[model samples]
Target: MKNKTGRYSAYIRPFSYFIDLAIINLFAILLLSENVYSIYFVVFSSLSWVIIALNVEFYEVYRYTKIIAIGNKILKQFALFTIICFAYFGIFSNHSNARETLIYTLLTLLVVAFAKIFIYYFLRKYRRLSGLNYRKVVLLGSAKQVKQLASFFNDNPDYGYHLIKIFSTDIDKKLAIEMCCEFTEKEEIDEVYCSLFDLSNLQVNELVNFAEDNNKIIKFLPDNKNYFARNLKVDYYGYIPILSLHKTILHDPLTKLFKRAFDIFFALITIIFLLSWLTPLLAILIKLESKGPVFFKQGRPGIDEKEFFCYKFRSMRINATTEKEASKNDPRVTKIGKFIRKTSLDEMPQFLNVLIGDMSVVGPRPHLWSQNKVYGNKIKKYMVRHFVKPGITGLAQVRGYRGEIETDVDMVNRIKYDVYYIKNWSIILDLKIIFLTVFNIFKGEEKAY
Candidate 1:
């Protein structure tokens, strides 16, 4: 049942984690004492936990599972965690951390690890007692796909999804046979998942109508291998049906919160600390170079095709306009602008853009209205890039796509990288991009005239 797994499923793991973390942190404090080595132990333990847990993918939580599976997985992951702990510390330890302290920490961590499992076991049992049932549903997919879905349902109990039938066909004759074969005259199906691939428009319509007639919730999970969705999963739950398709990965709530929060937090810090101090000096330089506003502003297409005034330091002569593209050796770029563009100091004003919540610290760099004009018509899925707020630096920028949009192919490839970044946005990925950006700023930075 969605009711049981909805909030409780999330809380269970986080609760288990906090309990384990508290136990480990408290033990480290008590036993390791006021030593820098204690920090190492905590870090080692945390790293070990994530590494082992991540490899097992239990945290993904896509289905319900049995107690045996949960208990066994916890055991396996915790064992891996402990092994990594010993091996990591063994290689890196100095003379101070005696075998006694190490043994105590290990014993303490083992208690915490088993506690995590025991806690889950208790919670699962309590939940079962509470009648926390999975959402009863039926599958409408190919044989292979339906079997895989059924197996997944059977395997992962935490998911809280119970597949009641494998309705592998979507045809009317076959559908009737399936209905007759799988369900008796009195049976009611709560949900009909149409995971069948390569269905014609007529077949899709028929299946949709059938689900609607039965008052059954229908969910379509397209094959991941076929990436073309024409922006399939965007548009705010289909209330506003537009010609364009949206990339769904960017709209995932955690990914959205993470990317936006990173943009806002780092943007504010930069605005207050770095940009605040740097702006005045840059303004003075720009004013001296030419008689124009120190900061440049232009309307850029943002998320959902919304328009916002993007900011940047004026990196060209006053006569340079928004419609003009930046050239490698443009005459409009001032002597100081040349230096700034080469060093990427010009993009410093985008910290304000970042703070305004119009851009990211690192993402698919926003394009001007005119460039979007040129490429939006030319590139397929070009408009989907607006699914999320654009960034100042992105996968494209670091991977040598920043400078000039020389060709349609260049923009296409650039969009490919942007889509890749959009699909794979994470805190760790952002951190890696930021690190790479810093490295590039100092090591072979591209000249953005």
Candidate 2:
């Protein structure tokens, strides 16, 4: 099996989806242009499918390649797409060309469903039979453990572990030589899975050097399976391999979706009901004491490092944006600014940012673009915080890592909490943070500033 064949087979899943969406989209315009919004409609729907599908491990090529399984996948994708499709349709249901009945839309959905299944399976079979796919892989651990693994491999041939040979990292060179001899002189193997735990701290560096010095691929079979799965991201493009500790949204998609939806809904409620009254009151107070705008808008980075304007009540004296960050007992803060800073009323307008998807009701708070520039240069992996949308309030804030950062220790700890939130993100965790925030808001603290 050649690298090209293996690469094509690995890519078939995503390719099938691209073709399927392309076909359904083409059919929508050709067949139902009168009622359906076909052009931008297809664009949004397809993009969502691609991102969400990839997130959900839909493209991961495991051993299962049955037609029944493929059919199930098509059905699942259609069901999810239907949810997106209906949401879009409902938003514009009042449009002149909207579908008359949900039933008609569902029928067309079924047609697209079958079309996708056909394309997916056709590609799978073609790749399985014709694609010269050779997966570069190594079995980890020693002869005993690998023999156990080999037994497992014998059971699951479709796994495609191209076992090259066994490599051992025994503390005693005599043991290593004997074991390597047994495996080489006796059994068939492709590559080795090394156990660093077998080596002393001093020898660990040498073993790593030896493995790196060789061109052979190395697989580390750590004792902790869950830890390995959680930490390792191994991506291979043909013979090229890359590893990283990256996150996929599928690990917690429902939570992420719920968080965003709640942000929008709560933000909408704030603007529609509370803002009308509060804004006027705040506006009068702000205008009486300050020459600046009633609402201050500043650019901040959001999810995936996209920039968005964040809104807040005018808390400080005019032209205070560039001079310094807001601080406790700062003379630059106006009477209204001082009160709002303590009470956190200044942050209310950011709810609008939540509604518009620029921020969340609860996430790591976005820093000033200037602050981001300052800290990002100083801190390692600081920008990973922007992997999700910034928020109105966050665990760091509620946990008292808020207000002025007087030291590097504070900023580092703040980032630590932020990354912790991102990695362990869940609806339950978010709900806890929201509850804590409301508790802090009413209980009130000087640090709220």
Candidate 3:
């Protein structure tokens, strides 16, 4: 594909990297007060930059790329590079000053981050002022979606896509393909977006072949009814592409690592400090109040709909209508059960579940096995919540969607928040939910039983 940000503007990212690297090395030399420039430092810096380039694709910053996202990617690259540098210095260097090296890393990171933000804003302003850096794109097909996409391009100048041609599939497919090919060949068409719902298999293959022959970028936006499906993920098994219905942010290795680390750390603290002493006390209290086991174990849908024994302090009386959910002022809940439930102290045992890897510290709360079956059938995307491990508390619970499911709307809205949490999962968001959960415990939730 032709350069979307104009040919000359393409060098900006590479040039910025080169300048940033020189500045970092200069700072290192000044800070270290080294007699000779260490070859180890030079070689490591070069190789680390290469690794960062491969990992981040730093030059692939498109017009639609958010400034915050760009800054984040730069920060990630810097973090990785800093880790390698620290390891190198820690393991090998006798004279390495940890404090100085730390200061150098922070300074370089700040410089890079500031440079990236400044450059991004500069480019955006330049594009808006000059009306340049726009890619000439062609749309094939007259589907309603095609028009909607064109509207988006027209509306968002920052997207940098300018539709120069629209070929309606209402006309002959062969002629449309030929015209598209000719235009791509004659003009600087950066991309061809095909939404040809009416095109046959052979015709679609022909269009793809023509784009390949001309070395033009072609993207297929399937006009299938499920195109607007929630949390759609495309996975490639060798050559075949499989469309997954739902996937969560935890699917990312980094996210999984961070969440798992947090889960383990938090669970360990709770289990060791609180549960170690509180368990016996709670067990005694529960035993005195109820005739059943101290802990309530139930089969609930966990990650991937795998049944796992979810553990909680047994709040209700033994065999108290297992099929029926406890409600406010329910007799099934013992006198002590009501207090523990209201304060969310009954859920303390789930920390063990978190430590054991059956649950996360923060995620969609698990539903009862039978409730999962019933709601999974009634609600459209109910089971999608199980894509991630069930949590002690979740976005839904923090947003007052917890407690008994009273209506179909209640379940649907709960699932909606679950999906939202899955899609937009972040460490900050998880912490916010945890904070809110704690806050709710203090302020009290009306739905808490």
Candidate 4:
């Protein structure tokens, strides 16, 4: 009694990747010369892309994730593909045309990236709006987490889970068991999500046996106490298993190295190409407009709540009193300051902060020391953003959560985006934020003062 529609679930992603790479190789052959080594190039590139993508679980769609997350996974897989191509061409190949080979690789990757984006969004919308394909799912047992899961399924039809029935402790135990068995026996339910915290071992065994006998998938929902354990990896040491949540993706050694490399590369380009002329010009403007230093250097919290000097082009008249947060049409903003702040050119000097390793090009933006203390006490998990170095522009800023915290709702929403950024850190996400930031600057965000 195998499931009919999802039977080929495992093959879908691999098949797509295979087709994409095949097209890329065919194009490369038609565009470039058809050398004897072309076959080897296709084989190596396809294998590398598939292997790396599988290792990263890049194709496994998480039901709760956003489309941006899917795009992030695609870009990360392509990044790995680019690396493998580099290794093959630079280290192993005897060809003198390494640059040309890299160019072909880049073009292929770009094509596949666009293809993945279309497939991901288009298929999701088709499935949701057309109501074409959906998995029949049932909930078992009772817990707060179970309700949360149910709410999520109801809210996101794009996830393709159709809830049929819920059997919980509120119902008679015997009747609940009977209904569960009946559901499985009829082959009406494709999967069962059971919360085991309150269930007896016998009850759990009964549910498991019924699911196995009916060829239905079973997933266990952790207790509400473990709600915060979203992204932790489980590991086994010999026979004993361990649940560890201390490490996050951004804190991984390889991830840190890769992000640091990107930060340096981006910072160097900005400094040499754009900032070299812009900084001197802005410095003179600030000097002529205001009676303070060219740069406003203030202490702000960085990773792990450590203090760092955050630099920005001075965008306000020197205030001897308490530095209150900027308001709409604040008189403290100088003429030059208003233009720089509105254009976000004031944040340009933070590239120096990025270059010096005090900050990143993208992460949670650091707040002033006073604001940090105030928000730390007011908001839950406010300090979690400190897990990674602060950035010049961040998820919250690009998402239009920047500027003065007019109310508690603003602060809370800002923290929510910050926490999300920390949990879902990726190079592609960083690049997306940077792209949005540029667009926002040009469009002129309403909050910009």
Among these predicted structures, which one has the highest TM-score?
A: 2
User: After superposition on all CA atoms, how large is the RMSD of candidate 1?
Assistant: 12.3
What is the Cα-based TM-score of model 3?
A: 0.52
* lDDT per residue (tens digit) for residues 11-94 in model 2: 555466666577656655665546556566777867877766655545443433445554566567667766777777778645
Superposed model 2: Cα runs more than 4 Å off: 1-230, 234-236, 239-252, 320-323
Residue clash pairs of candidate 4:
none
lDDT of 3 by residue, 252-344 (tens): 545675788899999999999999999999899989876889998887778756677889898898774776778879988998899899999
Worst 10 residues of 2 by lDDT: 1-10
In candidate 1, what are the lDDT values of residues 200-280, reduced to their tens digit?
Answer: 556656665454333344555565544345334421111211111333556654555556677888888877888777889
TM-score for each predicted model, relative to the true structure: 0.49, 0.55, 0.52, 0.49
- TM-score-superior candidate, 1 or 2: 2
Candidate 4 Cα lDDT to native: 0.74
Better of 3 and 4 by lDDT: 3
Worst 10-residue lDDT window for candidate 4 reads 235-244
lDDT of 3: 0.76
Q: Candidate 4 on 211-284: residue-level lDDT in tens?
A: 54333556666544553354434432222222323456887645876898899999999999999999899989
- Clashing pairs for model 2 are 6-133, 140-193, 141-193, 163-190, 164-189, 164-190, 164-191, 165-189, 165-190, 165-191
TM-score of 4: 0.49
Greater-TM-score candidate between 2 and 4: 2
Q: What is the Å distance of residue 64 in model 2 from its true position?
A: 21
Stretches of model 1 off by over 4 angstroms after superposition = 1-247
